[model samples]
Target: MNRKNKIPKFIFYMIALWTIFSTAHAEEIMPKAFVYTEVQNSVPFDQIPWKSRNPIISSQPGFISKTWLSGSGNNSVGGIYSFDSIENAKKYVTKFFPNAVKKQGVAHTSRIFDAVIVEKASRDIGSAHFGGKISTKPGAFVYTEIQVNLPFKNVPWQQRNPIIKKIPGLLSKTWLSGVNNTVGGFYAFDTLENAKQFAIEVFPKTAAKMNAALYTRIFDARLVEHASRGMDSPFFQ
Candidate 1:
């Protein structure tokens, strides 16, 4: 080989080392992952033996916190959860969680979100888990997601704020956007009745206006506070 064509040994080693360091740094800063799930046509929240499973769930890889949600009307049950990383979030949703619920529910749905990216927008709406505090009074929670064509950055979070603020009994909301152009939020409300009204009668209309498919559920926040606190939920703290 011609001497002129040869690369310097030091330069080559420097580039190699930099590449390795950069990759690891990126992973370190990767955002926390969020997961939401619902089991349809299931038994009432009181009947489900979630206490037996809390210890097992806390033991999962990358698990951080979780808040159980009971459906306002359908006897459905689900949870709003957080994890240390996106990979673990998807793993639980696709593999572990599904299998765990199979005996009790044949139909279930789940979505994973990138929590860090939307932190600012979520906070704007009173996301207690992010930094705000949930109402001291008992409350219910709502989860809603819609399909969209726009990228996450392009979604108009500000424009939707006015509409959401008008919701009666609303205390706070944490916005969410995830892989495959999904938009959604976790909402806290002062009363179960108001949450049911929004989930069943209000949010669907909003989704239709956006021309996107909607997925939503209402959970009894008060019922699950203890289990959630046990899992290190930020809201409880």
Candidate 2:
């Protein structure tokens, strides 16, 4: 082939490869958005470093939302952290909970889920007063890995939305199913007691009715940042 012809072909190939790479990694690492979560049993509030809140965090920079979740068990703690960049998320975790990634024991399970969808609230539930940093007391992040028998597309959306709209203290919900038949979701609640109630009272009858296996965990969690999607997305309000 001539030099001119070869150059055009090379440019085409380069563009193709870049497109593929970008699409593949788009959801895995959102445009400066990531979710970090950890779940353990009965993590004491004193151990977490980021305590006491100042309203300035939301005003100072990029997205920031933080809260403690409540699950059915009092002995469990699961923390959820999100940030504008992967570097920021990692730095916060390393600086405060340096040992957060390690396995403390059989009972303690710590995790960080960076691949999550940030959704917006459906109702007029949010205000500037309610916004900003509210991680006053350190608590656990609750995570339940749900695998329903039905495909995500086939799940009952009409029934699910009504229940989600009523729950309070639920900061964020992540719908984590890709092109697979089985789907997953990660929820960041403001309090463990509310999380526990939802898990026990709501999830069973609606979301996990046909699930073959259900996994639940908790951790000592701190809210590093909290930025979520807009009201356009379809989820519990």
Candidate 3:
């Protein structure tokens, strides 16, 4: 289809904006963004400017780790935030996020969810892990927000992993699906072009074959910081 969502020309501007600072321990995985219905007591706060002026979000209760996207248009705003537990994750969205927006003064609307990490992989293009060395440079990734048919079934990881392993330039893929059945994945690529190419070439056929109702968004993602116990290369369809 030759689809394109170009990163802003002001490249460095995005590098400055997409930043995530977090800490994690092994054996910790929690829910996805569960749209918080209640306003988390905004109670008077500071206003944060746009990207390039991201407020330093420190580690706190429920805060485990996160992945952020920079840029506009093709750029995304929210991120994958892991918490101590599903309850803790929900609390953060209902409590922390409202206040965060108030103090940061950033316009954001969150659809909270509690998702489980069904699979994680490091495409073999490079060592893609949950946690790794920190870097601020802009990187590219695409994650899908989808709904799958009941009795979800697809090609076994044993078979799919081999296929993805052969594709060139995939950094990593973290599969997450909400309890409500929202399915998607977090992926990192060497370039935005590569990410889009992957979205068009691989996802369509695979998802249809699996009967998964899916859609994808490519973004300028960054891995500011993380803590991992080991590497997971399971390819989830």
Candidate 4:
């Protein structure tokens, strides 16, 4: 081949290889998918046999980690889970998880989020799974989601950080941005009372100000530590 032609061909091959390498690297470091689920008015955490259920959960496709949640004031039980991909997370929540919880005879709520998109914002607030494992003193958790008409980019997550940090007993938080402008977070606090207070009184007022529908739940983080640790939960570590 001519020298000129050979040089151009080599450059093209190098560019192609560089592109492939960059794409692969991005995938490797991409944030994981997350799933949250809760059963209202269900059995107590101790009665759920969550520890024994770890084996089955661990064997699921793309399962990464899980944090078991027990309602603070009511008999609700739930979990926050991480998965390798959004497809797998959605499948687990819609296809696999529901059937497993049907025996409770109570309605459960589930939602999926693209963890990659909110990694920066979440980490700024000490999200454990996102390398911001600052406050490990969590004994309770508060989960909240508010439906809004705006897009995820307009959600003001950073602006709210200062206010959230001031809330009594707060430990860490992982922000969630879901489909159709539904945004929320999974939070950790020092006590169930504090978590419940935030979920019920503080956050709801914010939601009301936005005129958005809100979903909130408070959980006993201490009770489910064993079950969460068994599933390699980041919060436990």
lDDT of 4 by residue, 110-185 (tens): 8898887888888888887775665556889888888875666887877998888899999899998885557899
lDDT of 3: 0.47
Which TM-score value belongs to model 4?
Answer: 0.83
Question: Model 3, which residues run further than 4 Å from truth?
Answer: 1-56, 71-73, 98-138, 149-155, 222-237
| Poorest stretch of ten by lDDT in candidate 3 | 228-237
By TM-score, the better pick of 3 and 4 is 4
For candidate 1, write residues 1-237 as lDDT tens digits.
566556677678899999999986445333388898887665777776777888998888888778777776677878888877889999999989889879764788888998878877877777766766766644788888887755668878888877787889988888887766688888888989998899999999988998889877777877777767776665566
- Across 33-145, the per-residue lDDT of candidate 2 in tens digits comes to 33334444554444433333223222323334443443333534443434555556555555434454354553333233333222322112221111222333323344565
> How many pairs of residues collide in each model?
2, 29, 13, 0
Pitting candidate 2 against candidate 3, the one with the higher lDDT is: 3
TM-scores for all predictions: 0.80, 0.43, 0.57, 0.83
Please report, in order, the local distance difference test score of every candidate based on alpha carbons: 0.79, 0.43, 0.47, 0.82
TM-score of 1: 0.80
**TM-score leader:** 4
